[model samples]
Target: MAILIPFGLKMQAQNNTSGNKILVVYFSHTKNTKEIATQIQQLTGADLFELVPSRDYTTDYQALIEQAKKEINADYKPPLKNNLQGIDQYDVIFVGSPNWWNTFAPPVATFLTSHDFSGKTIVPFITHEGSRMGRSEADMKKLCPKATFLKGLPIRGSSVKEAKPLVERWLREIGVMK
Candidate 1:
């Protein structure tokens, strides 16, 4: 079951076990992270929560780069359009983001800080152009100190559609999927 939240954010229900309540939360600018999040959801039967920014980023490549650099340098966390509810019910969270300036996007940082994930297991995944994983895992670990961090999967942005096998393998390796 998928619930359509305000601002076009969709949350999908997990139809698996009740013990391991899973949530896949992500911030996707170019849809690469979104694609990976969808694959993870399929494999684990997890819920989906998309982080939509209140302010939309520019579509121009150079402009987007400049904006990202400015935000990262300032350590800015843009406001999210919709806030997620019932986050405490999840035990495992899969966080995905595009690699921006060797780190996760600013909006992902916002989402992390907004929620309290004291005892949840966090599995990170990144879609990068060339800088694989970048500093995303480290950054996330810093933000979510109390959560258990798993080995992250980094896929090239251009090859996201072909990433099902890799994503499945990582899920199995992490013991999220059998």
Candidate 2:
């Protein structure tokens, strides 16, 4: 008999061990961040968790922009559908999100505040059209003040599939891979 795993729970794990537990947590609006997160998980052998919002965003681009802008201006934190269990088990965390209005999506912020990241290493990655990393790193630092922040990677959302080499280079630069 074969065991079937649900798609959401199928986190990738490799045999490589660096003596540090790692987790890749991300919020993908258009699957761009999700793609990057998957690549990071494969490279670092980290567990993966997706940030799902209690309320869904619109699929329409213009509408999303309006909603995001409103939320950002209001400093809103949307409730999350699930919380990261066993968060203390990880020593290094890769937080990924799609850049929205020069910052991370509100759901990502919600996730960041929901955990205690003291002494953990936070490596940020963002997907953007032209804004690059935006204020994501700074914003995350504020939320996770006790966590060590590493240099971030920003990829063009449209070209996420070609981001493997870039991601690999970033992992080495951040000292996550030797």
Candidate 3:
């Protein structure tokens, strides 16, 4: 039984403008994070992009865990597809990913490193079983030292549908949507 909730006043309060160029980028293995990204796109008319690894992870849960662990332990930066051409056009970037070992997915890390975010604002949205943003906010600052990293929103992977309002509220606070 999936649940869906609309963005309420808290979200609307954050909407100070009617037009903003927002970009929502994420990488999902189980579709949980992607679903959240979709909702954000729908409300804000933000452009969306899914990070795809050069090689896909195995479908077996245990095998995927092992692979993720190895990458996290080694601080690996997996190769990513050539990013969206001219992604720099956006005013703000909303980065999303599933938490793996208390950090952003390796592919997302790869994408972060590949781009230059000199003066852009970055808002992180993470989905996890338990661990939330983990070290991702700090990691993003490290990766894009020139960009402004804002407060992040962390949601449970099991409660994504209930997250629409919260997600909208966040975008409003960050001045990404109206």
Looking at candidate 2, the ten consecutive residues that score lowest on lDDT are: 1-10
Clashes of each: 0, 0, 0
| C-alpha lDDT of all candidate models, in order | 0.86, 0.85, 0.79
For candidate 3, give the lDDT of residue 39.
Answer: 81
**Model 2: clashing residue pairs?**
none
What TM-scores do the predictions have? Answer: 0.90, 0.91, 0.85
lDDT of 2 by residue, 71-95 (tens): 9889899988777777897898899
TM-score computed on alpha carbons, candidate 1: 0.90
What's the residue-level lDDT of 150 in candidate 2?
Answer: 89
Any idea what lDDT model 1 has? 0.86
Candidate with the larger lDDT of 2 and 3: 2
Give the runs in model 1 whose Cα sits over 4 Å from its true position.
Answer: 1-18
Give RMSD (Å) of candidate 1 vs. truth. 3.8
Clash pairs for candidate 3: none
